[model samples]
Target: MKNNKPKYNSIIDAAVQVIAENGYHASQVSKIAKKAGVADGTIYLYFKNKEDILISLFQQKMGQFTEKIEHEIASKQNAKDKLLSMISMHFKQLAADHQLAIVTQLELRQSNKDLRLKINDVLKGYLAIIDDIVEEGQQDGTFRSDLDLRLVRQMIFGTLDETVTNWVMKEQKYDLMKQSKEVHELLVFGLSGNTHP
Candidate 1:
């Protein structure tokens, strides 16, 4: 198969770092190219513009992220374990990618409303994974019957997002994976059909 993927993945990676460090408003094509170790013209070969670059990066990384999570959860039979695996995978993935963590946690949010909306599309994969977990939990009678799956999904994502963002802002001084179990407990307690251990 043709390795038709971007000949300049390094450029995309550099763009991510540049955007993370410089913020979207301040990020420039020249800067990204420099960081990627390519001429500025090379970026145009793979991307139409800065916005396209950002969108592509998110879509690519998040897709791989979802795949890994899907594989991890598939190995578990219990919905509760699957849900925990899902959360753990997400936190661990972002935690390991410090540059990606910076871009997602802070810089990406700094984009304009239109850009944010586009970025939201890339995030749908992650969101859908959470929704699926909630559905599985409901089906297995582990979650509340009256639960608004959509709202519950948002709550789980929001809580986890906030947690990771705070840790990043704090310079990631602690272990992200170690904290995953506690988050699982909080979400499971509030949303699960049975609150008691």
Candidate 2:
């Protein structure tokens, strides 16, 4: 009921911008409310507190993110192509939204342990997408059967996560999308120095 309200999305979007500009610890509910063009009390209607706002922001953004990745990869016939599509979409989405990139890549990491745990819970859906791609690859012989699914998932996610963090730290002066293909290549082939056959 509350989610369907236009202000809910406005609050979420404002939170992203406010959090991106002011670090999560420094961001306040009143500031978010002002940016959302609503009274401070209005934010309380949609969120329990600032922590709830952070979690809800991640949930809303990452939910749309995972859905977009799913839609992008749906038509691909093989795991390799599907993986590439996923990687490209991941980079593209972040690259397109500088505020979101900063909030996710830099700001979110500053939260406390409990908040981090909640954020990790929000990430499972995105991670599961990676797990499925890895499982599909292994089953189809596109990936090495000996690979550990958990490790592979971590490697893929860690690589992408760190790359965006670096881009944000560097003030995003470079073209992140351009590196998608090379990053995909590195993940699929690795540092073995052997070209893909």
lDDT of 1 by residue, 13-129 (tens): 887789878888799999999888888898887888998888887877878888999999888987788878988998999989988988888877743888888888888988888
Question: Model 1 scores what on Cα lDDT?
Answer: 0.83
Residue 150 CA displacement from its true place in model 1, Å? 1.1
Global lDDT of each model? Answer: 0.83, 0.91
Worst 10 residues of 1 by lDDT: 1-10
Q: Which candidate is the best by lDDT?
A: 2
Name the TM-score of candidate 1: 0.93
Residue 138, candidate 1: Cα error in Å is 0.9
Runs in model 1 with CA error above 4 Å? Answer: 1-6
Q: Cα RMSDs of all predictions? A: 1.9, 1.6
